[model samples]
Target: MHKELRVAAYAVCVRDGQMLLARWVARDGGKRWTLPGGGMDHGEDPYDTVVREVEEETGYTVEPVALLGVDSMRRTHPRRLGAPVGFHGLRIVYEAHVTGGELRYETDGSTDMAAWHPLDEVSSLDRVGLVDVGLALWRERPGTGRVTGIPEHPADAGN
Candidate 1:
């Protein structure tokens, strides 16, 4: 039962209006709230994996600017605490524009905290549906669109 097809890269760092999140440990341990970015190191270049995962999970320094949707589905990689999933899960989602760093909180990496989450309180916290599919692909900046993944998960996003 191995049909893995993973390809990731995410970001949606708004500003003054607030958004720039990053607070990992999802997949059950709860407390999810993403945005910074991750995965994409094969031929590398999902916009350099969102500029090196937004400076390694929120040290800032973004600038992706567009391509704001592409979420593909098919589950079975949830119990991930380490890595190496097994199934289709292509996530591209971008729309950055931070320009610099300084938010801090890269506690040795895969994220811990970084602020600016006020896009109307970001669905009342407790996120994970890739934060409303990265704010609805950054407010349907959809020069394209497609979000269909739900064999079993995602439904905590409030607001």
Candidate 2:
């Protein structure tokens, strides 16, 4: 079986009883809300990756104040248009605060929209599992830094 590993960084930014989120547009045009962040570039620090990704996806400048937690998962999944492959994802979560810049939508990117949602209403939104995992890290502060039961892919809504 083929094997692949991906590492990404994401941020949780909450202000005034609301959280900032981005609308991730899948390759098939389906959309789901997720935290403001993405994959790390080669040789780049995960902290920098979170800052850069937040800006790229949400049009807001942010400063990651604390390392919230890290989540990892290994699973079997499809690769390209081929058969099953082993995929390991290492995701770093951070608690961030918006420093500057105006709220705007990202054009020509993985996410098309960015907006703040009330924290109380987050449960009703169509969102990726990562959002819940991030919130759990921020709220519960699990010692192991791993969040169990997140779906391998956000597109798998049943998970």
What TM-score goes with each of the models?
Answer: 0.32, 0.91
- Residue 54 in model 2: shift from native, Å? 0.3
| 62-81: candidate 1 lDDT, tens digit per residue | 88877878776565543335
State the weakest 10-residue window (summed lDDT) of model 1.
Answer: 150-159
Model 2 has an lDDT value of 0.85
Which parts of model 1 have CA positions greater than 4 angstroms off? 1-21, 24-30, 36-61, 70-93, 106-127, 131-143, 150-155
Alpha carbon lDDT at 128, candidate 1: 66
**What range of 10 consecutive residues in model 2 has the weakest lDDT sum?**
150-159
For model 2, what is the error of residue 15's alpha carbon versus the real structure, in angstroms, after optimal superposition? 0.4
The TM-score that candidate 2 achieves is 0.91
Whole-structure CA lDDT of model 1: 0.71
Q: What is the lDDT of residue 71 in candidate 2?
A: 77
Count clashing pairs, candidate 1: 1
